[model samples]
Target: KILSYLDDSGSGRVDLGMFYAVVAPLCGGHLDKRKRVAFEALLWRPVNEGGSSQITKMDAVKYIKLLRAIYIPSQGMSEMLEVHGEADDDTSSSMVTFNQFLGMYDDSEWGFGIMSTVVKLETRDRNRHGNQVCSVCRYPIIGSRFKEVKTGFSLCNQCYSEGKVPPTFKQQEEYKFREYGSEVEAMKAKCVCFSMQSHKNPIAT
Candidate 1:
């Protein structure tokens, strides 16, 4: 469609204003600025006629980027951003898209990488013992050290059992905790598995 706008005349390629008019209707007033620019440039440029005033793909790309910079960002885009959470442009999204010309679309499903930090309040035992230290091994009674909890006196697994090794090391690559008491699951997984006191109950993770 953009190719149709290219003016093959010797005057040179038309500006984004010309392209904007060309794409206004096609975009239905919601045209992603860059695409709108490309459609116009491709349509008005005379390059295809005889390569006489040919504009390279790079030329169209430059204009589209410019439009993106100037285009009034929609509140809808911001709302979508809030709902979807902040992410990198490369991340998958339902409302974000990028074009071959490097133009970004609000409706693109791509997302960006956005690292975040979270703080959590955690206790050690299923019993809700906020201050209880294990009787035997004195393992730290915290959500972070669940696996070390033992039957006899909340002793360290090493002290509680006959041997410090697992029943069978053959199945998995043997891993060890610094000190046993309770296990903390991945934060994301814990959101569902472990319950919060007010929200649910921060029981055994």
Candidate 2:
């Protein structure tokens, strides 16, 4: 899911700027910091990367669609635009400067909701395990990691995307995989599995 938004060029590789665009919004910081990240991510071209630091109405709409999925799932595109002080009749040719984007947040209630969502997502990303390596590629896993339930086997996002799995599990009829976004979630799954096993084979008291 992270790759879908960041891989704008469809080259199967994400540049550093694109990677930062996706992650910066999910980092712990003041609300303005996250807002700035979101704004830059909408730019036609990142200022430092050789394009003008300007956003068009179309740009805002596209980025807002992505943000709505993450931050305001309850709102429709038109309603989201209204929340951001964008009018449906606004000309697509108009450019929105950074200050104007910031002004919308300062003038609306949507900023509060964005702050809460960022905090929750940031906490989950922070709790992800840095030590877990992919059982297939043997690299340290980051972002979304997939695991097979029966054997504790794991795969990194890239490996899983390519349908790669551990050689030992190759002959299985089907993969019963579970996805984990953070270490806390994986630990909870382990606890649940242990509880189920204990119930199935209770010891004599």
Candidate 3:
């Protein structure tokens, strides 16, 4: 199903650009790149199945609901989809063109927040594990764990959401964390840093 959606050219094979258009949105990179990829994903359709490229309000609502399912799981789907009061009388206003969608990112603060959350959730590892424990709660980390770069402090998703940090470290007004899927990945990053440093300052006999 995803392949069909991405194969806009209707060719049996998906080209590198086509594949990147759909996959980049989930990989959590530059915000502009993610936004562009997302916009393409929403507008894409096989050339054989020609249709308007503009996304309707309903389309936007459905995408929003999918995001809500991850971040706001407690909220019922019906409640999220419900339209408040009467529907918009202006029919044309309900459609969002590519330019209009881009405008939302430029004009709305929450625009960046929403897209960032979407990328984070899509890229997160949903697998449960006990290989590592959260530094704050001392519980086995599940899914994605957030680690502070400066102090090597880690937090489980719940603790991160609640803004919990290691008691030894002073709480800051804001915290920056790198999300990792597993302890091995964190270790690999450490090893890479070590290798780079070693290259820069090689030992002399």
The global Cα lDDT (0 to 1) of model 3 is: 0.62
User: What TM-score does candidate 2 get on C-alpha atoms?
Assistant: 0.40
Q: How many residue pairs clash in each candidate?
A: 43, 0, 0
Best by TM-score: 2
The better candidate by TM-score, 2 or 3, is: 2
Candidate 3: RMSD over Cα atoms?
Answer: 16.8
Residues 1-205, model 3: lDDT tens digits: 4455334358877544335443554565687777677667666634212577776554444444443443344552454444322245453248777777667544443232355566565445433334678888888788788988887778899999998888788656567898877767777888998999999999997
Which parts of model 1 have CA positions greater than 4 angstroms off?
Answer: 1-18, 21-41, 51-55, 72-205
Candidate ordering by TM-score (highest first): 2, 3, 1
Model 1: per-residue lDDT, tens digit, 1-205? 3432234243666555446633443342223463445444454545323433333343333333333322323322333223323344433222212243333222244311010100112111443434445444565454433332222223343443433433433254543333432333333334554555336644466
**Candidate 2 residues 64-129, lDDT tens each?**
454554456566335444444444667366777888766654545543246566577766564587
Please, what is the TM-score per model? 0.21, 0.40, 0.36
Off-target runs (Cα >4 Å) in candidate 2 are: 1-127
**For model 3, what is the alpha-carbon lDDT of residue 5?**
37
Considering every candidate listed, which one attains the maximal lDDT?
2
Q: TM-score: which is higher, 1 or 2?
A: 2
